[model samples]
Target: MRQPENLIEINYAANQSSVDVDELGMRDMQRRVFAEKDAQYLLVKAPPASGKSRALMFVALDKLFHQGINKIIIAVPERSIGASFASTALVQHGFFADWEIEDRNNLCTPGGDSGKVDAFLRFLEGDDTVLVCTHATLRFAMAKLPASAFDDTLVAIDEFHHVSADKDSSRLGQVVHEIMSGSSAHVVAMTGSYFRGDSVPVLMPEDEEKFTPVTFNYYDQLNGYKHLKSLGIGHHFYQGRYTDAIHEVFDPDLKTLIHIPSVNSSESTKDKIEEVNRILDLIGTFEGKDESGIMRLRTPDGRVLRVADLVDDSDLMARSNLLGYLGQVAAKDKDAVDVIIALGMAKEGFDWPFAEHALTVGHRSSLTEVIQIIGRVTRDAQGKPRAQFTNLIAEPAADADEVTTAVNTMLKAITASLLMEQVLAPNFNFKPKEPGEAPEPGTLAVKGLKAPPTDRVRQIIETDLNDLKATILQDPGFRRAAAGQLDAEVANKVLIPKILRERYPDLNSAEAESLRQHVVVDSVVKAGEVKEVGDKKFVMLAKKYVDLDKLDINLIDKVNPFQRAFEVLSKSVDPKTLRVVMDAIAETRIEVTAEEAVLMYPKLREFQRMEGRVPSIRSKDPHEKRLAEILLFLRRAKASQAKVNA
Candidate 1:
């Protein structure tokens, strides 16, 4: 068959005119990306409807026609998707005639015909044609082709996550490693998101000396939805179960969109048919145009019908005729919304720019799949954006918790994809925002920003300590220690000595000697179960002589001094000596209120709270939870200080 002249003309026109390339949109960053010579691979990860494919299409076309490259290969997971991509690119560039696009199932080589294996080899041998196929096809092709065949070729792979290594088997991983190893081909790999550690090896194998680290960037536009809403061109979501709530929240002027998922199973098909018939009946009630310029109902139900069903004599044909008749009804009825029913055939490659709302009412496999379905409504038109409201009728049995996780995961994946493309691809760029399009002052730009540092590890330890302290201080027995038993020891051992030293540093030698004599009763140290001779120990005579009524003391002085001493001693003291001193200190007596008990002990507070009682210091696990309680008390004290300053 001779090549079509119109295809040739279109190709020639595309090469001569800059329309398609210009329409690719945004050039600044893409030009900067192309300038880098050291970059080994380009990774593009973009959200659905973010113009990733369009940008790539222009770049690929330019490189093929303008650059010296002889071959350009585009590979993806699905054959139909690949063909659709190639066809769109060719049609946009007017290059349809010069390309022989084929799926893996129907490929031909000059020598051996019909197998993708042979045909890919033929293309690799400087055949000067573009090859668009699946990743599996390329893998087989690579196995047959010699290493030299990769020279100067641009290889693009879409949906790259599918080729990632399975945890159980490394077969796909090894294949990717081999293909990328020592190849001179300029490669571009695209994916929504990559597993944390899985991406580096697949795209840039360590064994390959020429590999470069992957780069990323992101694009998120709030303007798209805003523009669509302003134009009043699309449907808005009405909460399916709470329609009144939706009405209360949203303006009545907005159009409503109802989304119904496919009921593809045999049993559900009957229900789906009935649902479509009911929607058709609803359309009959409108007198003229409703809030949405012209109301429309779209369902999926055409593939099951034959191409000749439009003119068939059977009753099935009459039902099949509903779509055309409905389209006519929409044209005739001034107030009517367009109603469409497609049988599993309307989703892929379908673009309805006017669609403003999408209501999802069924199960979905992945977040990416759901986004793709929703993306059908989010296209940009003449500076106006598409799609506003997305209403999902969540089934109670569909495991909403898991669905939420998957959706979040998918969104992250989309963000990661855009980031990769922005940072890595040389010929990719985003347009500068027009005046007044930037964020308002003081508003945070969270999307596409680098992550802030997390202090979670430190916080976890501190929180655990605080909790423990709160529990321990709530015991009645613990409260006794808090009251005043340690007060005498703390005053004699720590407070009086420190204060006396600080205030009267110039005391005469004779007075100091007299004071020391009065304070010390003996010089003796004891070993385990043994009385040692001539070892030094001090007993304060001031403890007996000083009048307790003359000195004012606070509870903090007693508790804090002992706590500090215990902390200091624990570090240097032998375990046996530490246990002896701890046992003696544990016998000390103090009094505490119920509030003070809970405030001082975290475990006690927790126990009280758990038992529906006020937190108390008198708890059984006083020692075990003392640390948390003390910490909590200290925190509250600090907070009080802050408030006083304020």
Candidate 2:
């Protein structure tokens, strides 16, 4: 479920955890992450359950116990995630000392507070080696205390996504910057997710370079799993809100965690009581509160199902009973938690090992939210082999005649946009060039670099590739190659390798050649580059497809996940047909004054007759749409001018 759209079987040595040196020894990435201990600042871009908390422990311990660091402050977004830094078994694993987080200093638990603002100053004045505090508390304390007060400490921030360059997050960001500038405070920023939906830089370019980055790709983590096998991400479209179609995706047999839509979500009616009642009814007969004030419910088929309501009801007893169950790691009774209805809880650090499926009912626009929900079910439990994430989105129900225009263009677009991000990481198809030759169109071949490449430049081409996505199917040369119009010998053995090297300059001649063949095989298998082979069933990559049962993992690792989907999408719709749609939506350019637009009203009427609807000023609409806008604008301006004259 990690960037479900862009899962590759690529492995990194850092992903392999080192042996348990003591008891709970460091993971391979953890071992490698610690090797950068000498760095003044570090950014560990690891995946969920990649033992980031433990890694931070080893580094913080080194800075405190070994290095001459004065103090260590750990900040997390939520109190629950603070438990990640709780006392560890590291001493048993041969570390110099175990991490002992005092309950009093653990602001997450009940303790003295002028808020944590006052406690933070007290802790800094004392000799506490490590203090775990939430970002809000730290932000508040930093306001009260001088930046120098936090100097000489290693300040580690978890769920680092919330710390960004935006003004909303600037409070904590400025505080961290101030503390670092005032004194020599080192920072270890950690986040499981890469990008925030709003597209703000987490750290400024120059500020970011100060930290050494250690990345553990999702493919590496899930691939290295001992018990968990494959992770599946799917989208199920239903009529109206998911409330209208819960039965389609929900399975009582699956240990599911359903993320009900927020009030703002299109699927949400925003009626919490109605939402709860509807869900309870779907599962079973809601027989009111049991002896313990918990809701007792039975399914339509006579099967007993225990449901825990995470939403607070107006009734104090019902709300209090649910609050009592808020932070429990797991339900005490085995049969008690068949389904836990939650909002704003049970996510990001709450562990539920029994979860087999993570289901959400909404259009979760944020990629960070999507990844976090997936993490809910990915935790490996004994005997549990696979996990799934299903997004139940509202599909518009319009009659066939209105499918293209009225049914729900916006709805489908939103759904496709969400799925596209999961299916494909924004891609840039880069190809390397020969000496003294030009780079491939829409690709920047890194060549003649006096110094090594930066992650930024490389990432720009990779993540922001959509703008420059190549028109492969439309290219004459590629089309000829696909249609067998070109000579096979020259096309396959020579031209393809040249293009691959041009696109991937990092790949040497041999590597490029290998990739070229793989790309060609991929192109042909997709039924785009090669035709006349009826019913293409096999796909050959780095190696030839050998048998039905086995696949070469190494070659499979390099296969692009987007190509299969791309081929189906591309082949289904004719390019010429798409052009017609574009023409239908295109707006004709015009130069007209307010008076002139009035004169063109009859011309606008022609469009209304032709299209069978009055065109409006739409950025996405055709030339006729612009005409309507122009006429309307002119009429308004003319009216204003007439008023002035009078």
Candidate 3:
């Protein structure tokens, strides 16, 4: 049995600063958001288990009492997440008031849609200050109630990525647009996964610009932890059914959450309940369910493992029983459960602090879902020194027609891991180096790094760097470049700017270039290894060591941001499988567009002038090889055009 490969292993500082509460019962992340309470349109992007719910309470309470907001309408993606906003006694923890929602006002409980919507309307009109409901309920309620009904209310949407800018497809997003456009309601959007997995913009550029972003990055949340010291992210590929290969990566000793593939996915066996039972049998002999409905499995050894089967939701009673038990699990009793097998229920907004390992058994299509699943195990808890996320993917068969799809899925998984690497590492403050300027501590200066030319660019660099990189890593062009099919410079100078302009259409050429430089610089630096030799530190960029303090933007741009992912892929998978992956990529990789050819033509000429010869396709240099490919592409285009004319 092959063990899981560790692609990204990041250790935190364990400073305990993030978990520490301030005078107002707010954790470090909460306090950061609370300070921006005055902004009517605020977006708080924080990692899970970072007290985003409590942070909303702090801000909502302030808005209700001080900001003249008449009511607080809190909407979550699902009903279970409403519990995060359940009435809390904040005054006991040194706050001005408590966050109390009357039972009737808490519209997230089990009930009919019409009844919940009626209750929602009653609460909005009545004297109640806070109401909790799911996004579906809110969307339904908004249909019945005019946008004016939301006037003077503070609407807070949790897991905000669910609301897309595409109003036609996203009803919740349409409701939000209506409220913002037709009424004067204050809005606060919060999300653990800032970027959506579907690649849709959560908000239109104009609407997003209205919100003042308060970003509490994963690095700050994890690095300031009290107990969790490190996080490892990796993927394992199995030739056949994943159930048979479970033992390869499954560790019974760790408190784990196993997310089985959805029945609809190709990787699934199509029988979720049977899959769960198969996993149970593999683990040990099934003793039976205990009184609380949690399955009791006797391992090969004497130890009995408590498994929660969320996949078998046909038995509502048993599912409810397990949910109740999981709800009571906390830091005090970290070992209340052993493993959880679920198809889809326990990803976002599901809190389990004791979860040390999240073993996901398929390629998660959404980066957002991956982030949330990882969040389940990242909570700070006593005795839980480390957290892990493992992706179990199906290896592509060279003979299969779906091999292309399989290869794409494999690359997507790799990209997700790479993005997490960027997210989990410590945040770096990068600046343009100035002549004779004194070196600053904790700040990285790169020669020729473009400084932000506008406030909009500055805001993007400050809050949206990871999100930008997320989009870039997922781009087909960047992935091909990372696989060594194209030049790193083409990806850095051409493909990256294209994404930036499309995402932020308002950006001029200069602004887009500035943002592009920052994205490339940040990614390349974070992807590189930092080494300290004696008193001096050096960073390995493009496989060459460069003085960390004297780095250059040009040097960083020459590096493939996903180079580490490629290296990991080469090491983790067998060469045959790797060949399959490469072949699939080459077969489907986007040909160089005429626009991209136009962009590279000048650079190709410059290369020819500098080297005193046209670049060779067989050149060891990626940049030269890319130019050679582009030259060939253009010549083929010219010959095809001439033939058409004749």
Candidates' C-alpha lDDT? 0.37, 0.58, 0.86
Supply candidate 1's per-residue lDDT for 436: 43
Candidate 1 segments whose C-alpha is farther than 4 A from its true place: 1-38, 57-70, 83-117, 139-152, 167-175, 191-350, 382-386, 394-646
| TM-score for each candidate, following the candidate numbering | 0.42, 0.66, 0.95
lDDT of 2 by residue, 1-646 (tens): 0112312212223222322233446777687688898788888876677788999989988888777898889999987688778888787766667877777678775444466777788899887777898988888888787777766789998988777666575687777677767878889988877555444556655566566777664555666566676566665545555676877677888777877877765567988768867887787887776644456777777877767777655676765556455445253334546677877677777667668788777655555666677777766565667777776655333333333231122223233333333322212233433477644553333222112144544443333222111212212233223222223333444444444443444655544444444343333333222122353323344335532122232333334322333232233334543333233223222234444354456667787788887767653433444466666777788899999999
Residue range with the least summed lDDT across 10 consecutive positions in model 2:
1-10
Superposed model 3: Cα runs more than 4 Å off: 329-332, 598-629, 640-646
How well does candidate 3 score on lDDT at residue 23?
80
The collision pairs in model 3 are none
Could you give candidate 3's per-residue lDDT for residues 1-646 as a string of tens digits? 3565588998889998999898878888988899899998999999998988999999999999998999999999888888889999999999999989888888878889999988988888789888999999999989888999989999999999999888778988888888988899999999987888766789888888999999998999999999999999988888888889988888999998999998888789998878887899888988887777777888998899988888877878778877877886633476677888888888887878899999998788888889999999999888899999999988888988788888878888888888999888888898999999877998988999989999999999999998988887777775577677666777787788888888999999888888899999988888888899997889898788999889998888888777876787677788888888777776674777787798789988998899899989776565676688789999999999999999
How do the residues 1-646 of candidate 1 rate in per-residue lDDT, one tens digit apiece? 1111110000011121111133224333333233432344655544344444544555565666766556677776655355335444245434322334444323321123236666667666645557776667776776666655776777777765455444244444445555556566666665543322221223322322243223222123223222332211111112123222222322222222344445552113345545544444433332333332233322232111111111112465454344333334432442343223344433433334444444343333333343444454444433333334332222111223343332222222222222222222122111212334554342212122212123321221211111112122222232223322232333333333333233224444443322322221110000001122354222212222222112112211222211322322344334544343343434443323334444345544565567775433444343533433444565777799999999
Q: Give the candidates in order of TM-score, highest first.
A: 3, 2, 1
Candidates ranked by lDDT: 3, 2, 1
Superposed on all Cα atoms, the candidates' RMSDs to the truth, in angstroms, are 25.5, 12.1, 2.4
How many times do residue backbones clash in model 3? 0
* Candidate that beats the other on TM-score, 1 or 3, i.e. the better one: 3
